[model samples]
Target: MKHIRMILINGPKRVGKTTNANLVADMIGRSLPDGCRAHRINMADRLKTLTNSIYNVRTPDGQIAPPDYLEAIKDQPLEIFGGASFRQALIYVSEVVIKPRHGKTVFGKWFLDTVNQVCKPGDVVITADTGFASEIVPIINQVGGDNALLVRIHGMDASFDGDSRSYVHWKHVLTFKDDTNAPFRIGDASVRPDVLARGGFREIDVTNELGFPERSAQAVLDYAARANWLVRPTEVDLELAKGPTL
Candidate 1:
């Protein structure tokens, strides 16, 4: 049977998850056999599309506005679209509208379907936007425990500090209030805590104090190797296998 390696990189926003994921993907691509490839997919791809549509903005080529454009206009008033700032509007649509109607795992299911349809055998698929347990659990179930790895990046400026009012929670759409001790809940369940409690997948906690430099990438690669997701030939083994120079 053909096997696909799926790596889900989970962490607070702006903490170099995407950088690390790309690094891991490049490493895996270099190590893969001929005809195999590595791909990086974002879980928020569809959400971003929906948000663009809500904003009713399009590129000159008629495509939806890209993320950079969206980021630039995130603070624009949505009075015509009937909301607050574009950023808050996206949060409202995602948390209060779509998720409540379609279920929390809707995006995860869509992502899994995309992977099954587009990914080939021996492909290494990585996503750096994982946040909720509702999303990760279903994807892990589809990929199987042995084939999936959940990497949690830590030590960044926005790292979660167990405070409901922390910037990490705010980035994830959690509301901030005077009582910072309250649990960070997105609906009924606590956000980060729920994700941490999920099992059935191999996990590596990467301390990315220096962002995704050579050292941090190597740290992630080492953890992946220990998790059995990567099998790299040692230098001594390669040297011994080499025949004497003719």
Candidate 2:
């Protein structure tokens, strides 16, 4: 164990997750030595080229399956395609067969590999995080789970702060329609707080008390202190907090 703290930022789109992530990273970095600082990696950019590469794929029976068709057939009975014929197809469909096909590619092992290679213990690694915990947490444990923290930034929902909106009483998810015929995804309120509560992780509600930028930064530092990370905000951290230039 290298004694590193990795802050995995989780939240829905348009919910100020990246902004808060940068602030937390800067605050953590400021607590470290002058030359060292927290490292924030936006995973989408790192995996772009690999995700874009085109691969010509043929199933076991020499039948070529396009990306869509490969995914469409994953859970169907093998009897339809013939057991032996589909078996080979299954092996070749990397995109379709990986991690039960979430909204996009799960990026599971490969993403974790990149994170492991780039970050070590004692360093602050904050990622625009995705991929389910099942695929990522085990690898993190290989280093040290004690040093890791998963921060789930729930979208700002002021209603939840009011007594009228208890967790059980309220359930509203925002959905988005794709203009270009892309997949229709829930946008406004898809992230569930209960699921994030698992794994004993800390929760920061951007909905109330810390919805604004400055408050969000303070909330993070406060949480770190409460958790015993012992962050003493320095001049550099103050400067970093002024704006997200870095």
lDDT of 2 by residue, 96-172 (tens): 43323432223433455566677665566676544234333333433344455555556454222211112210111
lDDT winner: 1
Per-candidate TM-score against the hidden true structure? 0.70, 0.53
Write candidate 1's Cα lDDT for 175-197 as tens digits. 21222222332222223344334
Worst window of 10 by summed lDDT in candidate 1:
163-172
Candidate 2 lDDT: 0.46
Q: At residue 104, what lDDT does model 2 achieve?
A: 25
